[model samples]
Target chain A: MVIDLDRCTGCEACVVACHSENNIGMSTPEEAARGRVNHWIRIDRYYEGQFPDIKVKYRPVLCQHCDEAPCEPVCPVNATYHNPEGLNVQVYNRCVGTFYCANNCPYTVRSFNWFDPKWPEPMQLQHNPDVSIRPGGVMEKCTFCIQRIKRVEDQADAAGRPVADGEVQPACVQSCPAEAMIFGDLNDPDSKVSRLAGDGRATKLMEELGTKPKVVYLEKAR
Target chain B: MKHLFLLLLSVALVVPCLRADQPILFPHSTHINKVHLKCIDCHISADTRDAATIPGVRKCMLCHAKIAADKPEIKKLAAIAASGREIPWQRVYGFEKAAAVKFRHGPHARHKVACATCHGDMPNAITAQPLVKHNMGTCISCHRQNNASDDCATCHY
Candidate 1:
């Protein structure tokens, strides 16, 4: 997935959609105060220049799902690993909560729950039946919506047709009001994501890390 | 001594029996079993990446609009639809906040494990049971036995 920072309105629709779809835990007011919100995809709010000329930038941040992910190597239990489809998949049951993967992540996208997340009686009804509610303590990060991708792939495979570019949008990408997020194969130059990634302003976050993240971010427009 | 023994046995059986009652009588048999509605019919989001969805009143109204027109239970759906209030259902199963497991049901369901294997016979079930253990041990063993990836981080956030 590639994000066009230029078009991001930072309305936070993507964040809310992801929370609802993925069953992301809600942090108590206290937990949020301590910076412990369990947001798989977060908009990195950045500020630049002096007040008169100051500019605010919102960059949606999550696991890069890198080709050479640093977290995958440091995992003592192999809780983190790369998949064939360029996803850095996380298996929750296998996680021992050692947090080695969290520490090793260059993007710091991984979040650990310190308490049992709760939803009041009726609110729980809204819980998505398709995603598991994560227990506290295990480390987690973005999987590029691996479940969604797998479903689309399986459907496509069954039909004997190749997966279409816009067919399987992740929650964030699908919910973006401005349609700033594009997801598709980077390997296919004809794909929208690939074309966007190749744009002159596109750059990988923390290129110095050499993690080779599949996610590409377009520079903020002046 | 016999009375005391009987008392102890009664408490052991009765006390826990009360706890076993679901917070709400969800009557899965009526909604799923007798009607033969798919589990995903009400929890429609399950077909996608979500789980345990509390369907909107409009969704319920589509059926209750005809099936139970004169019933009190049906009125609740109408009230909710009029007020645009989402029916809030308490979550039965989910990861403890500390476990941080990112368990997506779409992939698992897509992999040929019928919903009944994990959710039990919900269509015929009158009450919801904790049919699937969902503990780490249960999960890990299944994954290992099936050659599914057992990495701890796989499900953990």
Candidate 2:
């Protein structure tokens, strides 16, 4: 999904939805103070200019699911791999916690849980039944809702039909009230995501790194 | 031998206890059996991509205002609704952290997998406890048998 950074209000619905959907735990004030929080999708807030004319921007950073994912080749155990659906899938149980993928990620989108994540009793009840919980010591990242994708495909198959475009959307895209996140098959030129990816302002993070990220950020011309 | 057979049959019938430790002891049988309410009624969000989650107090009050206005639990629920505080529902069944699995409720529910499959006999449950132990092995085994993707990435991030 390409997020228009310019249009994002930083309302954080996507962040909250991501947390609820993916079970990403919040870091304690102590841990957050030290810059260690488990956020699969984070809004990168940047400050530009100074004093009176100061400006701010919010960019959501996540596992880019790069076509040439740097995290994939470096994993000794093959814990991290690219799925056919263009997802940089990470296998938590298979991850040996070598931190190789974390180091290799140019976007720095991966987060390590320093401690057993806690939701404080009933808060844990709010955990989404769909997503798995990552324990400490394993590396984890986004899968672009492979479970949902598979579910959609299964449903289509049960009905003896092909999976339709826009039939599946990740939580972030579904919850974005601004409709800022557009998710679709990039292979189809008619797909919303494919057309958006070709926008003049579209660019990948650290493109020089040559990761060929499926995620494209549409920059607003100032 | 006849006595032993009867004992084993009873154990098999009762071994899977109805009361597990769910966050909320949702009385599905009472709501479903007595009141004749549909599962989707209280869980209004189910039709969407998300699960049909526990309805908030307002939804409860929507009918309880007339249905069970005098009931103690309903009255208390009304008070909570008036206070604007959200219901603190505990999850009965879920994946633990470290698994890094994503399980969507809507898709499964839509697939005709009875709520009882994972939740286990919700119509009889008093408290939500672990009816099914979900591990990687169990999940993958079912997927493999059902011709589902057993790819580790299929469940994990």
Candidate 3:
């Protein structure tokens, strides 16, 4: 996914959409106060220049779905591994709740489920049946909206055609009101994501760390 | 309090037995053999919706309103329809909520898996009963057979 920071207003529509689509349970006020809150796609805001000449910039960060994902190697259960599609797939059932992946991650994007997700009454019915409701004691992170990826993949397979450009839009990309996020097959050179990644302004979140995350962010323009 | 606990425990133990005796004996044989209705006839969304939809009383009434209108079972269907409440049918096959399994019927139906593939010969069944365990292993083995992805996230996202 290529996030054009130039366009992001930090509306957090992507955040809200991810929670609903992925069945991410809510955290109480206490949990949030204790810093146990979960927001898979977080909008990191920073202010540049002091005093009245300040400028606030919002950078939306998610799992880079990195190629050289550090989390993959440390997993004793091989629960977190790189899939053929270059997506960092998390098998919740296989995860033994070891926080090694979270510790090793430079982005610190992965959130451990401190408790089983609870949705009272009709709120439970609002859950998207496509994605599994993650149970407690497992580390959860962004999977590029992998369930959405699988759905498109199955459709493409049935049609006997290559996944077209813009065929797969992760929840963040789909729900972004500002249209800041871009998702496509990176292997396809002609794809928008590839072209955006090739931009001079585009840079990895932590290039020095060498995680090689699939997500790239275009530098905010002056 | 002790008696209450014992009663609750007995009720919990007996619930499965009660479920075995379905509200209505579905008589899959009569529908398939005598009526010549396919499995998808009433379960119209079996190939489309996530779960093969259990037929509402309306779906049953579509045919029963005329054919076998006087049969005791048909009367039950009609009476249930008139009450404006859905049939209280227990689900015979499903993964637990915590298993985090998501099964779609469209892809499976498109793959041309027979009705008996996972469900056994439901047409010959007297009442709804799960033929396969639908465990992770059971699902994985089948995917292996078909050269489909058995990725944990495929079902257990």
Candidate 4:
């Protein structure tokens, strides 16, 4: 996943999209006060200079899906681990809710389910059936929408062909009105995400941490 | 020794009675053996789609309309078809939502995996029952044998 900060308008379509697509539990006022809101992807706002000469910057942050993820080793139950496809998969069933992985995360993207997810009357019908409604006592973050990836992969495999570049779009990437995010196979040199990764302005968040995050953030070209 | 034998005999007799009857006893044996119908004949999407969907009342009425029209079960099915409401067939085999197992029938069917492999002996039975227990172990063992992916994300998102 490559996010172009230059294109981001801070509209937060990705945040809304993620909530709807992932069946993330809605946070009550009491939960929100305790800082227990669930957001798989969140836009971080930074204001430079004083009010008169202010400039706002929005950085959409999610699970970096680090190759050498700090969260993986800390998991006692092996609930969180890097899959063969290079995704940091958090198996909900296996999770014992130790919160060790959540503590070790540099990005602070992982959110714990404080209570069971509840959807009001009609809202229940809107849930995406592909993604599991994660129960309480499990830590969940962005999966890079693994369900979407698997669905495309399955369809491609059925047709006896490889998954095409730009075929697998995470909810955030698909819903971005500015087309700020790009998701594809980073291993494929010709892929758009790979191309963006090699761009002069592209930089990984907290690269010095040695996490080797797959997401590349393109600096706002001033 | 005599009391133990009596207790065992009562349990054996009562267990069969405990099994709930289906809304309509649509016999798979009669359809498969007598009419020579394949699994896919009724379950049209078995090879092409994720769900091996149970055919609606219309599909049942297609054959039951002319053959055994006098039968009580057929008359009930015909009434359902006439009312344009789907027969509420109870699912025999399925994973719980929490399991998050996205079991697609298309791939298995296309791979030439016999229907009896997961769904045990449907052709010989009167009504469908969960004869084979479908758990993670069962899926993993088969995948390992076929050199298929045992990756957690492959089925569970």
Model 2 C-alpha lDDT per residue in residues B8-73, reported as the tens digit of each score? 999986655544343333556788778887767877756445555777777777787788678766
Number of the candidate with higher lDDT, 2 or 3: 3
What lDDT tens digits, residue by residue, belong to model 4 across residues A1-222? 999999999999999999999999888888889989898999999999998999999999999999999999999998889889899999887888999999999999999998888776788889987788888888999999987887798799899999999999999999999999999999899999999999999999999999999999999557
**Candidate 2 lDDT by residue in tens digits, A1-222:** 788887887888987887788778778888888988788888889999997999988888878888888888999999988766667788877888899989988888888877666775677988766566777887777777766777787678657798887889888889988887888888889888899999999988888888888888999677
Ranking by TM-score: 4, 3, 2, 1
TM-score of chain B of 3: 0.82
Over B1-157, each residue of candidate 1 has an lDDT whose tens digit, in order, gives 9999999999985553334354334567787657777878777756555354666667878887788677765676577678877765556577675455556665576666677767765665554555566777878887898888765435544
Best by lDDT: 4
lDDT tens digits, residue span B11-69, model 4: 98556434447778778878899889999998889987888888888778877789899
> For every candidate structure, what is the RMSD over all alpha carbons to the true structure, in angstroms?
8.0, 7.6, 6.5, 2.9
| Candidate 1 local lDDT, residue A91 | 73
Per-prediction DockQ: 0.26, 0.33, 0.50, 0.57
Question: What lDDT score belongs to each candidate, Candidate 1 first?
Answer: 0.76, 0.76, 0.84, 0.89
Those runs of model 4 whose alpha carbons end farther than 4 Å from true positions after fitting are: B1-20
TM-score of chain A of 2: 0.94
Cα RMSD over interface residues, candidate 4: 1.5
Best-first order by DockQ: 4, 3, 2, 1
Q: What lDDT is reached at residue A62 by model 3?
A: 91
Binned by DockQ into CAPRI classes (incorrect, acceptable, medium, high), candidate 3 is: medium
Output the number of the DockQ-best candidate: 4
Error of 3 at B58 (Å): 0.3
